[model samples]
Target: MRSWCVLVPTAEGELVRRFLRDRGLLQKHLAIQREADRLVIPTVSRVEIGLPAEEREFDEAFAPIRSYRDVIRIPDRVRPLLPTSFDVIGDIAVLKIPDELAEWRDEIGRAILAWNTKLRVVAQDHGVAGEHRIRRIEVIAGEDRTTTVHVEFGLRYQVDVARAYFSPRLGTERMRVAERVRPGETVADPFAGVGPYAILIGRRRRPRRVIASDANPVAVEFLRANVAANRADLVDPREGDAREVLGEIRPVDRVILDLPHSAMDFLPEAVAALAPEGFVHVYGILEAADRTATTVEIQRIVEGEGRRLRHLLVRNVRSYSPTQHHVAFDLRVGRA
Candidate 1:
């Protein structure tokens, strides 16, 4: 049984693997082969593999596979009900399975494990709830574990998925906010869950100080662990309500409010904690068509705090639901 493959120089094997993984084109069942200093990588399709400058296809006689869909081995009856995608965090794969697929949860979990050898746990997201916005997940395959060490942007974060709210999807956003921090500036990440924002800022930007706080004690514990794991010497992890913590850390150069659902409720405290002409990054969940209303509400909140919004940059971070969006507003505020 021969299979088609993409040929490239052995030196470019890692690059090709990353490219395939990023594009979701990697063929997990076919093992990579070596021939005369070149690597042959099995791919899902032969058309437009998006080869880099250093890679090229090698001519070989092989039978082409039917489709990548066959690799998962889902029954035709249940195939349409399968989730299109899932999140891989460290050694765990978190899936969002619909109730219709409830009977095949275990099968779906096992298939996810087979899809990625690095994954040791397969969990299904039951949705986020409560004040901390923590997700409830059920382990359907492999080891029953919720704690995992995830690495992003050269920083390591230990997260207990059940106890803390952490999302790998926000990795880029974290770096984006960190890159905006100027050296020697004091930052306040009032809702710094697991220290993603605080640790990234302290490690990459080397901010003078980062006051990271969370209301959930379990999350705070992970935050402290992550701070030390990443050797973020400038980060100060605290366990308390964000409003109270911000009050104690008044006059910070930058303030990050990441409690998307309730961040607006703490606008006054964030404004009070900001230094003169400071920058504030606020994340909120809003209806897709309510961008104007969100802006007006934020502007009103700042004005009520006796601050004028000097500059405002609004961005849609991601889609929270079919009708809602995860939006971010970067506001540069000063005395009115």
Candidate 2:
């Protein structure tokens, strides 16, 4: 018996996996990082079967992307803006763009449509980039070099991801943190990016109030637009970190701490602002080998605060690096 692993970049893998269907080539390996330009695999098969000669028949037959060239790199941001920088995290092609651009937004978008053939525009940054803010353009081009636009792409977001862009990955760890809200409960999202969670929750759950914010002005503008677009029930959109404006809002039944790098440092302030028995969802990515230790660290933080941290459950969300894991531990904080 012989066995091996072959890692192919997302675009290439996506191109070939269709052929290997039911052959048992794809394994459930942890897709560590998102923006992978190529795929590294473990496989005993070494023969490269090139694509058919009909690739030129379609508008977008090859991969679609542009080089950010490290002028700036979005850190810890898995689902980023498109056609700028990209990496392959498992079978997905993660794309991201810069924070600000003058006139090239449309140009950048056209580049994506030109590169990734019949690609599905899964997400977008809002109409700040005009009609093509961040949408999943459904263009299909494959082996036969056939291109078809089946669906005129609509917003992937059931709720506009404008004013609050909660990282979609966070849902892996904190499943529907906002979706569980009851009517008349106050909620706040301090680090809303384009309102990933806020809009969905506000529109669906009927929360009494939801205050969302981001330090980035562009993010705030998008958040507001998303709130309006989705018809968010009761939300107050702000443009700064939640901690700074926490004093101005009603006491919240739940608080989402999504600040990058040091959300743990915000624990003290978060505890102070939360209502009695309020729930908090925290995000942290640690090494795979450290899963046990990482869970322990989260428990110790809330325990050290002398509060009773209940529901101490840990979720291995996604893969960041080779041996590193993106983990989220959720707990309910109350008086000790």
Candidate 3:
């Protein structure tokens, strides 16, 4: 049958498939056809996923419905409220069920599992909490365990979703920062969650060392395991408060601050650890209307610590809310 398909190279099949699957765009009923070095993946919706779609012939397979909405036994009036997509962390699916759909969570969970054969667990995320920034997840269907291994850019990371925070959404952003590291330069990631940024930078670039620190012991434990799993010898995992950890490892050539909500609060610690003309990659959640003032305040923060902002680049990473954005500030600072 002729269907909308994304022709992805064999090397990039897994990445693109996961991307399409997470967004509920992948058509699961059709058998993907292999042509030369590319795999043609069928998609249900026309989403701009940086790849062009073309009509291709796929073997029609007797498979279950591809979307949870298709199998969910809910009334037509409340069908619109069913979540269209969920986060897939490894084989685990993290979904947020609204109060209106709370009664049918089990049915929804089962439906979601049926949609994806690779998913071994389906968890309900009740928001992140506490100093460690852990998600309060409850297993709705499949396996009861929260531990899983997530892969990004061909590197493996052991992640306990309930005990630690790891956002697969930042995979591209992590690689972006990693590609910026200069050889022989020491990088410090103060808010390293499971060593994503630090390990990525260590593997991608020949940094002298990548110091990864986190207050959460579970996250740091996984970071250590991930560093070893990937054989990222340059990445050193440390368990402690970022301020204290940064103090112990002084004079870093670059620093990564990933705590979006409270990253600015630790700006002084990051500045204190930087070498002359050192770089700092800080993330924050900023109001769209206050972008100008926020940039000015960032400059002020850098200057307040007796360091002049030699160069600054602002990037809006993603949308946090209707009026707020997750932003990144790339800063190079020198002596005042």
Candidate 4:
């Protein structure tokens, strides 16, 4: 097994490992090592991962992944890598080849254009640079550890700008709110990361109010920047948890509950904070990957609110960290 250490931002250290570990290939091909606050993943290849079958047979196969490219041990430009991934949150993509092959990056990028008809690339000295075409790719810092710093070099596109607001990428949870939020209505996003739903809604429709909030200072900073960058006039951003902010804030016509990991836990707060007859977009990454499973979770929240899950809209936004259903539900609560 060939190994190349992968260094990532300290904040992303855990996620970096989980993202790769969730793939379950670690036992067979990869290994994660921790050095202080950084992460190191020994990838197994010098070649690219091929396209996985459209339909997976195994249960763990749906894990969120950067690409299906076979893990590479050695770094090489023009190494036929699957430099893009759509199924993961944030659409996270990686395309760092060794600086040794700066020329090869362009050559390989052109070849990729042949295989992936939709993608377009603008190569710099780095590997590849283009959002939506390729979300991110930079040299993994190779120092005491093999990890390289994430140095992005690309044409910042709409998606790149939009990334300022999304958690991973714009999941169904966010898209649901964008489609449903009406003009002249206030929408609250409790767990707004970089304001994807809020900013997107502001641009797409006439939301009288859209307040997006996040506890992570890093996320909050970006959220504010994104809202202002796009349409600062209508959308107001608050930095804090929904539980803390919504309790003291005014009412909203609609609410987007996107903290799927803890959304159910916050149902009480969401329902209590909701406006009379207001719309609530609740998201939950459930175990059962179906509408029935989603409804069950929705009912759990509306149990005592004198509200029933009147109408349930279900969508599989994307694979949630693999195998866990990344499910979104539009619940119309009826007065009990």
Candidate 5:
């Protein structure tokens, strides 16, 4: 059957195979195919393997049964609750375990580490909390550390998941915003977390300057280090509440409001910091049933701020929960 495969030169096939296996990315059920000078190896996921490999799909035969669940040794009744997927951030695997499976968390973590050889830590995530929006993660297996270097689009970010909020799932959304940034434009990220959006924009776009601020001091520390590592010299990292920090900065051509929980609360501050005819990318969690109502509410807020809503584009980024969605509102505003 056809499946996702990585094509690599015959000389580097063994090395790449080891790398993939170590990362728990190699599909154990499929057989690797040799094609003259190149070898086709199947993978469990489609991602950059940091090797000279080309992603392709081809017909391949299945091997013997080898799944993480097969060795889990759990009761048949609770087997269905076994997580099939988790978030992989660099060398760490984060799992959101159900409350019922708390007793088997250590075994689950071990199974995950066995399934993926490259992971050094396995953490059970209890979601974000507190004023800093930090994740409540506990080490269930392997090393006990929340710090790791995550690579996205060739940029390295030293992230501490326990101290700050960083979502690997937002890679596409960050790129979308970065690509829209025009040259010579000044950008501002009020809730910049580890400089994901800011560094990407600074390196990819020829913006005049990017002022990235966050209320969390640890996030700012990592953001500054990431800016230097990524050579995004144009990004100015600031540590303070965004409402106060934005007031100190000059008017920006684009403002990014990433605090989804209460981004709308700061729409007035965002509008105030924006230059005339500027853009604002605001993210929020809204009920999926009534998207139109959210748009109307945004229109009401923008007009109330004495600004003309020249343009507004609403995009559903992803499903935040069963009933709510993570939404992005792209707005272009000017003096009324």
Candidate 6:
């Protein structure tokens, strides 16, 4: 069937498209078609009579609806509150819906399914809670299972989101740390969860040995499974407190502490476990304004252990919240 659309010169297509999209006038399900020197974009409303010169009314004939916005059927008043994106792990879709849109969770899940037929589950995130830092998720659609194997950088990780802590967002950060690892050097990930960091380092850098430890037994189980799945033989999966684990495997060439909220509490153990001239990759959550103070504090911690910081590099891994960031400090320490 034919429908009303906005026609614009090909040169001004993107501008007009953006204008329509910003105003929620663009019909996402219909594919943009081109004829002669003009582009035809379908719209839900035919109220473009007073629009700018680039956009003019036209009849769009026989264009199939390939994709549509998730909130197409939702009331205009509530559409703006919907989240535009979500995280996907394996066949599961994890969404962080706002409280205002809580009632439409099922509709949102169905919309996600419409966007990707491969996704088998849609789970709502209630944030990470408790000492394990496990995500509290409520399955709103599809399968009820929470366990899945996520593949990143050609490595596979088996994680149960409800039982273990894992973030697909950290894939690049994991690779960055792995790239810094040198072959023939032993590495330790004291707070390793599901072996994402340790397995990646072992598989990519081929380190001499990687000791991966996690206090959460469920995480340790998945870590061991991931090691076997990825055939990361160099990683030794251990289940225990990071401080105790590091104390047992002391003097490693590199140590990775990824517990952002409380990684500093284990700094003493990290310093004690570092071999001479070894590096420690410490992850923390800090405000942008407090970066300098945090760096100084870390330096003081190292110095308190009678060790000198030979070289230190800090980077903003990601934003933890509007006011805070997930930061990493790569420090090369040695005897004072």
* Alpha-carbon TM-score of each model against the true structure: 0.80, 0.53, 0.80, 0.54, 0.80, 0.84
Give the best candidate by lDDT. Answer: 3
Ranking by lDDT: 3, 5, 6, 1, 4, 2
Question: Least accurate stretch of 10 residues (summed lDDT) in model 4?
Answer: 146-155
For residues 8-102, what per-residue lDDT tens digits would candidate 5 score against the true structure? 88999999989889989888767798889988898886757654455555555644336667667677888899887777888998879998888
Off by over 4 Å in 6: 2-72
TM-score, model 5 to reference: 0.80
Q: Candidate 6 has which clashing residue pairs, if any?
A: 29-65, 29-67
Native-to-model Cα distance after best TM-score fit, residue 179 in candidate 1, in Å: 0.7
Residue-wise C-alpha lDDT for candidate 2, range 1-336, written one tens digit per residue? 222334456777665554443465433232322235754333224434442211111121232234432222333343254343443211122344455542344444444444554443322333233322333322121222211111101222322233222334454333356556777878778777666667666766778878887777766776687677667757788887556876666467877776534566666556667786877767665766766775676667767766677777677666655777666666677877
Regions of model 5 farther than 4 Å from truth: 1-67
Between candidates 4 and 5, the lDDT winner: 5
How does each model score on lDDT? 0.84, 0.53, 0.89, 0.55, 0.88, 0.85
Q: How well is each residue in 214-246 modelled by candidate 4, as lDDT tens digits?
A: 776656776676566565567787778678877
Clashes of each: 0, 42, 0, 24, 1, 2
For residue 14, what is the lDDT in candidate 1?
A: 88
What's the true lDDT of residue 49 in model 6? Answer: 44
Best-to-worst ranking by TM-score: 6, 3, 5, 1, 4, 2
User: Candidate 6, residue 197: CA error in Å?
Assistant: 0.8
Count steric clashes of candidate 1: 0
Model 1 ranges off by over 4 Å: 1-69
What C-alpha RMSD separates each model from the true structure? Answer: 9.4, 14.9, 11.2, 18.8, 11.9, 4.6
